[model samples]
Target: MNQPLLEMQDVKISFTTSTGVVEAVRGVDLSIYPGQSVAIVGESGSGKSTTAMAILGLLPGTGRVTGGRILFEGQDITHFNDKQFEALRGNKIGLVPQDPMSNLNPVWRIGTQIDESLRANHVVKGSEHHHRVVELLEEAGLPDAERRAKQYPHEFSGGMRQRALIAMGLAARPKLLIADEPTSALDVTVQKTILDHLDTLTAELGNAVLFITHDLGLAAERAEHLIVMHRGRIVESGPSREVLRDPQHPYTRRLVTAAPSLASSRIRAAREAGLESAELVAATADGEKPQETVISVKNLCKEFDIRGQRGEKKVLKAVDDVSFDLHRGTTLALVGESGSGKSTVANMVLNLLEPTSGTIAYEGQDTSNLSRKQLFDLRRKMQVVFQNPYGSLDPMYSIFKCIEEPLALHRVGSRKEREQRVAELLDMVSMPRSAMRRYPNELSGGQRQRIAIARALALKPDVLVLDEAVSALDVLVQNQIIQLLAQLQRDLELSYLFITHDLAVVRQTADDIVVMKKGQVVEQGTSDEVFENPQQDYTKNLINSVPGLHIEIGTGENLGLAE
Candidate 1:
């Protein structure tokens, strides 16, 4: 192998807080050869990003490189001044940040932003800059390059925005690209395109990529080398295939085993276990009935008022003649990318937003024309768990109070009863009793989400709507949440309206699946039928776009683990 394009030796980064020094990266070693992709895999707060920041000389105000040697092209750059580092940025090294919305200036046009990046890197201005920006967009595989250049970042979709970021990074033709979760928020289709483009461009340019993400499958697909980070330390490092095929570290093995596709098998096994358990009891004869429909939507239509430069028009058809049914005591997943009307359908079902047309029947009761009072009553029958854990819960309230609010509001129980119920709910959701006193900020994302689920269940609702519930969590945490949801459904006979962009999650939790595109249901069927023999071209494309789909052994077995 050729000499590495970049190397970090015995690197250490720490933040000085009032409590003490917080070491974010400790004794880390990494190298990226030209044209090779290296993935730094870890959960949030695992020091992955901190290490990347140190490499880019973009660490937070409080963070300092306490000890390290950062070498680029065999040259030591530990003490490079701002001007020197600035010269390297975009020209020598480019960064694709985790949050595209946060990284791209909201006010700037996409083309202008790319132009500015090029200018900063001394890539020429005026016509030359414009031409380079267009070329970069083309290279990034963004369609309608000319029109997209004039559009603001807000106008672009999540995937398009991410592509624009990649275009910006490629504008100066940098030697190295540091991408932090580049495809994290994108749908499988867009993710595949972006990653494929990255792979192609990197190969053509002989440029190296320092990719960072928690998705082990993605790492396996796009990277050649792998580094596993945990609590500010590099726990493992090796060739990507070798690392994934035989992960020496326990954390890596756990992540591999926790993947959604793998979890689907576990779900299947659990279902079989339940069937066996039912057979064991003489009175519980093999009389288990097939699940029935819980919520059914027919010809659902929802149009959004698009306040555009032209004028206010109902041009955005958020949900267009969508039809689906949620089975009793089973999950019916609505899968799509952002703005595909999955969330809009969920909102309409919850009565948070009114649909322009169509009928929503809850256990055969038409819900389209429900009055405010009727809607309030309907709320008791159906509960919602939102995507963001922090945004869903009231930070001011304790965990116990948060969970109890729904029961108290519905007048289900007295204060004393509510408190006892909340404790029971927490226990049911696998939360610690001690957590009742903690605020939302005190809990982990997974823990906070468990509380949200408990609150959702407080009404004893027959149906639950979970919108991107586990998409925000890391693999292991997501697996746990998925398993918990399945177990809860079995125990309480709860039905789920699971809306997600994650195909893996859909496969795990959804018995039936609905694929939506441009506000319409393009396909609908059982998970097995859809996954095994997708009829619609869109559905087939979605299945094909799933990263590492061909590699079914999972990170655990691939990484070399034996249960």
Candidate 2:
């Protein structure tokens, strides 16, 4: 390859804490050639983001490079001062951060934000700047670019906000673009569109990309080269296809096996790998009699009246006559893009939101007519796990307390018994006993999610309303959680109302699937039926939107593993 556009030789980073110094990034070596796309793949706290920060001189708190060098265009930049770094930041190296909502200022208009970046890089000025902003928005795939520019971040959807970020990142035509989990929270179709746009634009502009993410499948699909990181160290690195086909490290193998896209391809793989029970697999077989319904929804409708800018009332039909059934010991996934009413249906079923019209029956009892005491009793039979564990969990509470609180509130057992139950719940979720004393901030994303699951199970509910529960997790953690849910469903005879935009995950964990669009049910059927013979154009589009869908995986032989 030509001379590397960027190189890190034995780079080390550390942060000062009250206890002592924490070595976040150990000695590491990496290189990126001009116009090349490289991905650093790892789980949370694996130092992937830290290495990127080190390159951009944006490390948080007291973090600093303690050893080695970072060379850009054959020039040492490890010791560059902040003033010097600022000169090159937006002009030569641009960044698209993880969370668009948090990164973009809420008070600023979309056009103003992009204008700031363009101005900072001295790319455009005067009347020409406004036109430049519209051009950038258009290039980023936003429709009605001029109108969108005047809107605030809150007016745009998650995917649109991300596109704006991408436009800003590419505003200056930087030589290098660092995208940190840019599409981690987006729907599969939106993710594909954004990634495709980024790839095409970067390639055309001859800009190298340093992509950091926890998703091995996405990394393999998007980048030419892959570098696997584990505990602040490089575990493996090679051509993306070669590493995926024959992972040299055990960690890499785990990542490949855990990918949702690959895992969804064959349900038999779950049973054959012993991740689930044979009986559970048999229950879902094509010829088996239908299971009893646990929760039923009919003619569900939810509408909201909003005041427009001119003070005119507007009726928004968030959910329109949606209906579905959740069978005992089975998972029924509600899949759709953002604002498609998947979460609205989930909320109505959970009784957290009152429907404008319709009936929701739990065990043949109408939840709408349930008395206050009856509703309180119903809480014991149904529990929910949210998308963001960090937001759901109480930072002030320990893991033990978080789980025990539900048991205590329900008066399920004695104080001693509740303590014992908390321990058992931790074990059930595969969490360490030592973790019981730690706060939510002390745990990683996956660990916190496990704790959330443990807490949810403390009530021993018959049904779980999981709203995008595993969408934020890495492939390995997501796989583990999926297997745990399957086993629990079999052992406890629990039903799940799974809501998500990820059809890949829905295919693996859901027995039945419901596809929603613009507050309406576009398609609904068994997982096999929908995946194999999608009836709706929207359903086919969703299936086609899955990343790495066409990338073939080796049949165990390439990885030197037994089938």
Candidate 3:
């Protein structure tokens, strides 16, 4: 075999804080050969990202490699200064970070950012930078590259922005391309497109890829080798399929069991089996949804008037004649890519935004012209939990205060009763009561999400608008939250209008799915029906985008034990 493009041997990383020295990565060893694809999979704080940062010399805040060596082309570059690392960064080692909006310059045009990368790395002469930028964007699967190149970051959709980042990363055709959770925020179809294009580019350029993600299924699909990191140490490393199919470590097994792509069908099957055994069932014998409709929508339309720079008028149909019924004690997931009007639909349903032409009926009551008091009453029955756990919670307030505030606002009960209700809510979400005094900053991402759920449930709402609630979590944490939601739904008989781009998660949780594209419903059906046989090309693309389902890891084998 040829010499490894990048190598890490007994690498140790640490950070200095006011409290003490904290070891982030310890005694890690790995190698990335030329054109070889590899991934490090782990939950938050598992140090998978830290390893990538070390290799790229982009570690933040008092972090340093305390031991071992990192070799690039058989030369030790572990202790290279910023100037030395800078030369290698966009030239020999490219990076595609997790978030595009943050990585991109909001002030500059998309083409400008790409041009800067080209100029910095000397990929092309300055005179040829603009043409090269357009070529790169088009190569990254973005359409209408010439027009798209002139647009700013906010003007582009999430998928387009991601393509721009990929273009920037591969602009120099680096020897090693590091993708840190690159498609975590994207929809399944767009994610698949991005990964496919990335694979092609890296393969064509003979560039090795180091993928960082919390999803084991994604790792298995995108890479040949899988490295599982937990608490700064590599617990398992092998062929991706072998590791997923026959996980030796407890953590690896947990990841496989929880990954949505691998376990979506299995989760549904298991949940249904449990329901069949139980005295109470959510569905009928024929697998039909409950006849009782909780929220009904008809001909919902939202239009935004866009005025051009010269004051020319254009109409943007955000939600075009969309209609769906949310049944009692069932989940109806609105699935689509960004700007598909799913979130806009959710907003109107929540009564936060009014539609230009539509009717929303809560329990057969039209909500269009509800009185102030009636709107307040409606809110008590319908609460929303947003996607960002970190941003949703109030850092200044304690967990108890955050949860109790909703109860206090609604005047649900007396002060003592509200306190008791908050306690029960915490217990329902499987959170320790000790967490009540802690602020959002002190808790992990999963814990914060649980708190957010608890807060939303404080009013004993009949419907929960979970807008990408668990999308930001790790697979294991996401599964835990999903299980919690299931238990809550069974106990409370709550109906959910779940909004997300994650079809795999929807496959397990949603009884019915409303697939949208360009502000229109592309397909609508039962989750099983939709997943088993997608009727539309867009729906099929979404299902195909989901990784690891094609890999045969059955319930009787690896996953039954996972459960």
lDDT of 3 by residue, 232-302 (tens): 99999999978877788878877887887877645445555663422112232224457699999999999
The 0-to-1 C-alpha lDDT of every candidate, in the order given, reads: 0.83, 0.88, 0.88
lDDT value, residue 542 of candidate 2: 93
- Scored by lDDT, model 1 comes in at 0.83
Between candidates 1 and 2, the one scoring higher on lDDT is 2
Model 2, range 1-563, lDDT digits (tens) per residue?
Answer: 58999999999999999999999999999999999999999887889999998889999999999999999999999999999899889899999999987888999999999999999889876779999999999999999999999999999998899999999999999999999998988999889888998899877999999999977768889999999999999999999988887888988887776777765543445444655533223233434535899999999999999988689999999999999888888889999999999998988888889999999999999999999999988999999999998899999998899999989898999999998999999999988888889999999888888898888899889999999999888888888888888778877888889999988788777889999999999999988789878999999989888766556665555544454
In terms of lDDT, the poorest run of 10 residues in model 3 is: 277-286
Candidate 1 per-residue C-alpha lDDT over 1-563 given as tens digits, one digit per residue, 9 for 90 to 100: 47888989999999999999998899999888888899998988899999988877889979988997999999998888888889888899999887786789999899999989987888775668778888889889888898789999888887889899989888778899999888887888888888998898898988899998888778877898889899999998887767756767888777766766444433344444563332112111123535687888999999867777567554788899999888787788899877788999999988888889999999898987778798899999899999888789998999888998888788987888898898899999999889989999999999989999999999889999998999778887887898799788888989989988889778666778899998999999888678877998889888777766555443323534333
Error of 1 at 381 (Å): 1.6
Candidate 2 ranges with C-alpha deviation above 4 Å? 266-290, 559-563
Using TM-score, give the best candidate's number: 3
Q: What is the TM-score of each predicted model, taking all chains together? A: 0.90, 0.94, 0.94
Model 3 residue runs over 4 Å out of place are 265-289, 308-310, 559-563
**Residue 556, candidate 1: alpha-carbon lDDT:** 24
- The TM-score between candidate 2 and the true structure equals 0.94
Ranking by TM-score: 3, 2, 1
Clash pairs, model 1 backbone: 244-558, 244-559, 245-558, 245-559, 245-560, 246-559, 246-560, 247-559
Cα deviation at 508, candidate 2, in Å, is: 1.5
